[model samples]
Structures are given as C-alpha cells and as structure tokens.
Target: MSNLIDMCNCCNGCSSRRQGYTLKLSFPKKLLVATSVLVILAMVVMPSEARALQHKIRHERRQHDAVALTKDARIRQEELRRRPHRRPALLPQTKDPAERLRNLEAERFKNATRTIQKKLKNTRRYFNEERKVLNETREYRDGMPAWLPTINFVAIHFHTYKKQGATLSERKFAYVIPKLHKSLKEFLEIFDRLYKVEVDFADDPFSNYNRTRHELIWNTTRRLYSTIAEIEENMAAVNVPEQNFTPSKSLQALEMKVDAPQCLKNDYIAFRAYGNLLNNWFSEFKCPHGKKVTTKNAKCAAYEAKLIEKKNKRNKNTER
Candidate 1:
C-alpha cells in the first residue's frame, strides 16, 4: 500500500505537477463559476408552486393593462362625442313658400348640372391621363424586378379594380334601380331629398309648374332605367380579356425573405405601378351606349345655363 501511494516514479514522476495544474481558478473567477452553477441549478430545480405564483402575477398584470386600455378608449370616445361635426348647407332657409319654391328649382338645376359636368370630366380624364399612364407602365412592366414589391402591388390593383366593379354592380342593382322607379311616393321622396322642397297645401300637383316638374322626373327616371338595363345586357354579352401584366412568383417569395429597407423599396415600386394601371383601365372604358344614356342632354343643359344666369343676376342685384 505504501509503494502504491508513492508510485510517481512508475508514472514518469509528473503526476504531482499535473494535479497542481488541473483547472486552477482565481478568487473572482471561482466566484463567477459558482454563481453560474447555482443559477443553472435553481432554474432546473425550481418548485411548481413558485412557477404558478409567478404566472398568476403576470396574468393579473395583463388583466390590469387590458382594463386600463378599455378605460382610455372610453374616455377618448366620450371626448369625440362632445364635439359635433358641422354639415354643409343644402338649401336656403326661407319662410315664404314662393321664394322657397324658386330657390329649390334653382338648386335642382344647379345640382343636376354639376353632377353631369363632374361625370363628363371624370370620363375624359380616364381616357386622356389614365390611358397614357397605363400604356407607359407596360414599357416598365417586363423590365421590373420579379421579386420586387411592384409585382404584389400590381396584383393588388388588379384585385381592387375587380372588387370595385363588383361593388358598383351591386350598388346599381340594390339601391339605384329601386330608387329610380317613378311611383308617386318615391318621386315625392326623391324630389324632397334632392331639392330640399316640402310639398304643402299651396303646391297643387295638377298645377302647371308641379305637373311639368313631375313629368320631367318621370322621363328622367325612365331614361335612367333604360340606360342601366342596356349596360347590364352589354356586360353580359361582352367578355373582357384577362390582364396581360402580372408579377412573377419567384420574386414574391424572395420578398418574404428580405429585410425592412429592401421591403419598403419594393412596396413603393408596386404602389406606383398599381396606381398607373388603375388609371389606364378606367380610361379605356367608354360610357356604355354613349351620350344618350348619359345625364347631359339639350334640355337639361339649357335649363342649367338659364339657372346659372338667374343666379348671377340675383347676386348682382344683391351687390347693387
């Protein structure tokens, strides 16, 4: 046993030196290693009750946060309610029936004329400005990066236009068609809404003025119905070709893997392309069945011009 304890000679007499060199740590290093070991041990051996208590505390904090957020939202909503929005003046405030009637007539002409002119302007712009941009965009479409945000934006524009077209079709079918029917009840309601005129004892339906206006509305309603019917028939008959331009799939996948700055740059490219495409599509479409189906006609135009002249005269008289 004594020989075994002193067997350094058999092991080349270096065993003692090796033991001394084995993982010698300084005081601070020893403290750091001990702390790390204790931390790991604590994490591994923590009690379930302690963990449940911690979870309960965190859940209570989240509930408190949610309650605070809801309260803040209610306060903000109440503040908003205190401030009412102002509406635009739709008609002149008058006591005399004759003056009110005259003003209503003037307003009818003005509103109708304005509506017609706006429609015409929008139509013209689509053809000139919108068409130009779309044709130009085709030049860049093939050259654009496949993985670019522009591709997605173009896709979005295509889908948006389709959705808008569908919505317009629904609106026409659901609301415009029913409202445009010229029954006596609907006629009165529509006229009241549009002209801000109330029908009272003084206004006889059989009187020349009332009779003429009623006939005009009826004629206009019939024309609108015919136009809408024609549009539906034409749409059913004509099949639009599929859009030629679209983004490549490979680029769209690459976009998912990229960082923020690259993503933003791609997004801008897509948005610009989409905007141009929308304008182009809208421009090419001719108002179905031409000007006859449109609001602008000889009688309405003349009446509109006459109303404008009368308005100018009244303003001048007030100035004098």
Candidate 2:
C-alpha cells in the first residue's frame, strides 16, 4: 500500500511538469498552416462545382437542339399540308400478258393524239394569219382582166381531196396520214411559188407590203412543215405504215403565174378550206379504247385481293 501511494505521487509530479512547458509557433508558421488548409479545401470544392456547371450547360444545349429539331419538323409538316395533293396514278393490276401489251399501246396512242392536237392548233393559227394578210392587202383583192383564161384550182381539188371520215380507224389513218402530209407539202410548195412571184412583181421588193406578205407565207410554210412532221412521228408511234406515193402530177401542174391576182384569191380559198379540214380531222381523231380490266373481271379481282391482303399484313406489322 505504501508502494502504490508512492507511484501515484510520482505520476502527478510528471503531469504537473509537462503542463508547465508551453509550445508557441511564430507568425510565418501560423500563416503557412492556414494557407495549406485553404488550398486543400479549394482543390476538393472547385472540381465538384466546375463539373456541376459543365453538366448543366451541356443539358441546356441538348434541350435547345431538340426544340429546334421539333420546330423544323412541324414547319415541314405544315408546308406539306398546305401544298396541293396529287393522287399518284394507280398501276393497272392485270394478269394477262395480252392485256398489258394493249394497255401500253393505248397509252402510246393517247400521247400521240395529244401531241398531234397541239400541233394542229399551231397550224390553224398560221392559216388564220395568212387569211388575214390576204384580206387586208389591196394587191390580193384586185380582179384579173376579163379577157385572160383563168382556172379555179381551189374548186377542182379542195372538195375532191380525200377527207377524214366520221370515225377514224387505224387502217384508214394509215392511208389518210400520208395523204395529209402530201397535201400539206403541196400547199407549202404553192406558197413558196407565190412568195417568189410577189417579190418579183413588187414595185419595191423591200416595201412593207412585200415584207409582210413574205413573212406571212414563211410562217405558214414553217407551220405546215411542222404539222406534217408531227403527224408522221405520231403515225409511226401508233405503228401506222407511211405508204410511199409519188406527188400528184395534176396538182404539181397547177402553177401560180406571176401577176395573176385570181390565182392568189383561189389559193387563199384553198388555205381556208384546208384549215377547216385539219381542225375537223384533229377533233375527230381519238385514241382507240382498250378493253378495261376492272374489279368485276375475274383476273383483276384476284390481283386486287392479293394487293389488299398484302396491305393488311403491313398494317398488322406496324401495329405490333
């Protein structure tokens, strides 16, 4: 018990000695410690704050891009809705090879008919201009002297020429197209002859009247040749044979003499008559109708059923 009391006394004496001694840091050392703590705090906090700010910026940019894309899509949809909608032509559903061939032929015939009609309109316009020019000119209206022998070629040929029948058949067209071409060619030749004669007989070859007449005939000739070429092309497209025939000797022999006013009048009459004929012919010519393959037909019904079945299968897939 005495040894234990002695040990306790010794521990208290050592603790008192240690408490009496004070450890003090200088100003520089104190400042160094505070700076180190601040540096450690900045390293940890700054990185986390920077990462949060970057993530927010990235998210905002992505949102803006998405909104722009949505706006563009909506604008495109509105534009499409505002535009006129054209229904796409449905392809004919046919099983027969013969029917397909006929369909193709019918399409070609229709295209050719449309093109010919357009060309015929141009031809009629040219003829009308030519008629107007002839009517307005005093030289064209002057009568021939009563003593001279005159021939009315317009009366002889205009009515007698083979005209288009009420109904135009492909077989008849084969004959008629070539005849029309030949007749137009003859008319062109006659106009060219008349043009030369007018120039030769004019007091001043470069006079306004001469120039106007020249322009009128030139236009008429060009349009006639254009119409003839269009007819030939369409005829070939429709598989019509262009029968090769020599020019009519009788028509060729009927020449316009220089200074013959009666010849001009007759020619004008012929031009008007032929113009009427062309308008009538084009109006009458139509594409031949093909046999329709409707849903009522057995083959077409089967084809349409297959299409419907495929469409339903597609719709089912989309729904799934």
Candidate 3:
C-alpha cells in the first residue's frame, strides 16, 4: 500500500494538501512523519485479530481446567460408588447376629492379611506399633491377685514371643481372654456387692464412701471387666463366653479353680495365666505363714512391732 503512493501524491508544505484537493496540500514535516507512523501501526494492530487471540487463549484455559477437574471429580465419585466386598464361599454367613459380625470381621481380617502378606517384611513397623497399642490398652485383671499393680503390670509386660507360641490372631485373644475373665467376673460381683453393702453402712449414712480415689480406681478393674463383657455382648457383637463362676459339668473342660483357698475362691473360674502380679500376690500374702490375726490365739506383740517396722522401712525406700 505504501509502495503505491506516487511522487505526484507526495505533498510539499502547500502542495494540494487540502481535504479533497490535489493542490494546496500543507502539512508540517513532523506531523506528516507522525501520520505515516500511525498508518503503519493501524495496519499492524487489527482489533478483531487481537480480540480473537485473547478469546482463543481463554477457551483453551477453560478446557484444560475442566479436564483436570473432571478427572478429579470422576475419581471421587467412583470412590463413593464403590461397594463393600463379600467374603469367600468357604466361610458361610450365620443366621445369628454375633456369628454374622464374626463372618464380616473374618472377611475384613482376610483382606488385611492379604494386604499384609503383599507388604511382606515391609510392614514390621506397623505391626509392632499396633501390638503395643493392643497390649497396653486391652489389658485386663481381677482384684488382689491380678489387680496388684506390680505383679499384673509385670505380667502384662512379659511379651509373648514367636517361640512362646502366642500370636495377635483373633483366635488367640478370644481363646485366652475368657478364662482370664472368670476370675474377673467373680471379683467384680464380689466388689460390687461389697460396695453396695458398705455404702449402706458408711460412717455417716449421707457421707461419700471412705475409699480414696486411687483405691476406688484400683478396685474398679473388676467392674471394668464386667462392663467390658457386657459391652462386647451388646455393642461390639462379640460372643461373650458363658458367665460361669460356679462349676457346671458341661463347661468343666474350661474351668480351672482353687489351687488355694478353696472356701474363698470361685468354683467354675478359670483365671488368667499366672501373670507376674497375680503370682507374686498369691505367693507373698496368701500363704499359710501370712496368717491374719486370730481372735482366739494372736501373734506376739514383738512380732507385730517387727512387721510394722519392716513395712514402714519398705514404704520409705519405695518413696525415695
């Protein structure tokens, strides 16, 4: 277009510079240069072209974002729509609620086992962590023998190694715990009955129990066991072993009773394996030598003084 401008069309200061005339044209050299630059810029800057480029950029951006968002949304929606899997055919579903729960739990366990097997030796850390939580939080005990802090805590601390043939399988937990719970139930019934009896005969009828908070806590392990059993039976869908503190011929295979104190001990009870605390409690205090004061024939006053001195010294050393 510039090349087409002829020498005749080129304007002198007053050479036909009027609007529509070929003669008398007049423009300053500076103004003419500016006008020429404006013409070149106008040719380069078509408004419709710039507008189309911006619109195209915006459209492409929207498409890219929509693809990413659609992918993420699809993944989430798929997750929500996923169904829980059923168990294998070998493990039949029982009509009982407890058995049904057990079946579902077995499936869950199988899935976990499969996943863990896939992880191979890589899941040792996770396994160890879970073991710690289970042992710590799931510990149970009865009063006196099992409830003595030192013995029971040590017993719990005794970890069952692979060589010991103890595993964290459900069968192991279910198998061993019910026996432990019998003594627990007996203790609980005794304590609850004791508390009820004592509360009625308090020093003041309206007064709170004379027991210390720690004492109450110490005694409450039995109650906790009872409550846990009830909760398992009702809420956790766990089948609680039949409550048996008295001997029944049918469940005799499960009952292990009274190595000592046949009169005081519950009959149909199978207590916890001789855990450290329980063993120590029975050994130290339940012996024939560990006699209570006899109303008819008492120990010597000198023996009492010596025992009191020993007890005080032990207490002092323990505090330190």
Candidate 4:
C-alpha cells in the first residue's frame, strides 16, 4: 500500500510539471501571434501615413508656387506703374498703307514748316550781326576803290542740280536756286555801281561828274528794285518750275563790260550792308508750293529699307 501511494504521488508531480511547461509554451505562441498581428497593422497604417505626408508636402509646394507667381505679378505691376506714360501719336492708325503714308507726310510737312521758320530766324540773326560788323568798318573816305566781294558765295550755297529721285525740300530748293543765282548776279552789279557813287563821290560837290555818277547809280538801283519786285511776285506761288524762263540778256552782255568812274582802292562796308540787305529779302521769301508728300507706292523704298535694317539690328541685339 505505501509503495503504491508513493508511485501515485510521483505521477501527479510529473503531470503537474507537464501542465506548467505547456502553459509556458502556450504563452510564447500567443505572444508571437500578437506580434505578427501588430506588424501587419503597422505595414497597412504606415503606407497611409506616408501618403498623407506626401499629400501635405505637395500641397505646400503648390502654395509656394502660387505665392511666387503672385509676387512676380505684383512686381510686374509695380514696374509698369513706375514706367512713364507714352504719348499718343498725332495721327490715328490706318489699315491702308497709302493713307498712313499720307498722314506721315502731312506731319513731316508741318514739322518742316516750323524748321523753315526757325532757319529764317537764324538767317535774320546772322545777317543782322553781319550788318553790325559792316557798320563798325564803315570809315572809308570818298573816291576810295570799293572792295565788293562777288555774290558767288550766294550762288555756290544756293545752287542745286536736278536729282532724279529727290525729296520735296530738295526739289523745291533746286527749283528756287536758279532764280536766286540770277538775282545774285544782278545784285552784284547793282552793288558795284552803288559802291562807286556812294564811296567815290561822297565828298564831291554838286557837279556834272557827280551828277552823272548819281544818275547812273539811281537808274541801276531802280533796275535792282524791279528785279527784287519780280522775284517777290514769283515767290507768292513759288512752285513754278522756270523751264522756259530765260535769264536777262543784259546780265550775259555785261559780263566783261565795266566802265565805272575811277576810285581809290579801299574796303567798302556800305556795299556789303546793301548786299546783305538784299540777301535778307531772298532769305525771307517762303515757297508756298514746297509741300511735303508721301509716296503712293514704293517711291520711298530707300526709307523703308533703312527702317527694316534698323529693326533687324535691334532684334539681333535683343537676342544677344
């Protein structure tokens, strides 16, 4: 009976140990299963979290881009505000090239008229200064040989030849130059005669010799006056091309004919003043017909070509 009881006790002890071991193993298995489940949840939740982070970063980038675009637009607006306002052109834009050209021509003509007026003012000022210089040097005695410079200076300066394709101003200048040349020639002759009487017989008493000299001077002055009057009349409508008009025969005839009274050789300031006075008249004469014009077709093709070249150069510079 005692042996049997001891054996049963041993068996119970073994069974208890086995139960303890199984409980420990079962705890480990449950722990492993819980760990595995947590790993699976982490795998699924981390992807969603990463996607949310990526969405937030993309939204931030878009916002930054929007801000940058707004800042750039504001800067452009400020820059434009700081810039000067451009003035509108006098002429309105036209689709027709001919009409546009006509408008441009009209504007140019208006501007040219103002330029001509300014030139006239400058001419008068210069001539007035010359008159003062001549007056200061007017201390010559009677019978002095007057030193009258020829009017070739006027001829050289004013003469213009026929150019095949010339501007309106150029053509007008050419048309007027011939008449000016003729007038200058006549003026030189008149000046020579006047200088003879005014300088040579300044101190002479009333006598036949002086009277003859005075008469000759008076007649010459009258002729010069007539010539100036004619020029002034012609200038009223100055576009008339004098193709058929002939210069006076007397001018050509008297090219070498000089039978003036003997006089002492001296600088004559009065003659210079007289010549300049006549020049002032010529300077003031405005040509009513020197109107500016725009070409209807490719007449001013040269001007257009130059404009295109200028634009091309500008574009190349911008590229660089």
Best of the candidates, TM-score: 2
Candidate 1 clashes between residue pairs 3 or more apart in a chain or in different chains:
126-283, 147-251, 150-270
Residues 1-320 of candidate 1: C-alpha lDDT, one tens digit per residue: 35435645655543654676332432465888999999988887677668888999999999999998899899988777665233323566899998787666544433333333344344334333422322122333333554333212222212222244233333223322222122212222332222222233433322444344344444434543443344333323332121222333443233333433343344334434434433422321222112342236554344334445666776799899
TM-score, candidate number 1? 0.18
**Global lDDT of each model?**
0.41, 0.58, 0.40, 0.47
Best by lDDT: 2
Off by over 4 Å in 4: 1-89, 111-116, 135-247, 252-320
lDDT of 2 by residue, 123-223 (tens): 87667766676544444444333222223222222223244431233334454456566656666656666566532354553365556766877888788
Candidate 3 lDDT at 227 equals: 43
Predictions ranked by TM-score, top down? 2, 3, 4, 1
lDDT of 4 by residue, 132-198 (tens): 3322222343331223323333333234556565455445544544545354455546445444444
Worst lDDT 10-window in candidate 4: 287-296
TM-score, prediction 4: 0.26
lDDT of 3 by residue, 134-191 (tens): 1121123333333211213222222243433322434433433444345445444443
Better of 1 and 2 by TM-score: 2
Clash count per candidate: 3, 0, 9, 4
Q: Quick one: ranking by lDDT, best first? A: 2, 4, 1, 3
Error of 4 at 196 (Å): 13
In model 3, the Cα lDDT at residue 125 comes to 29
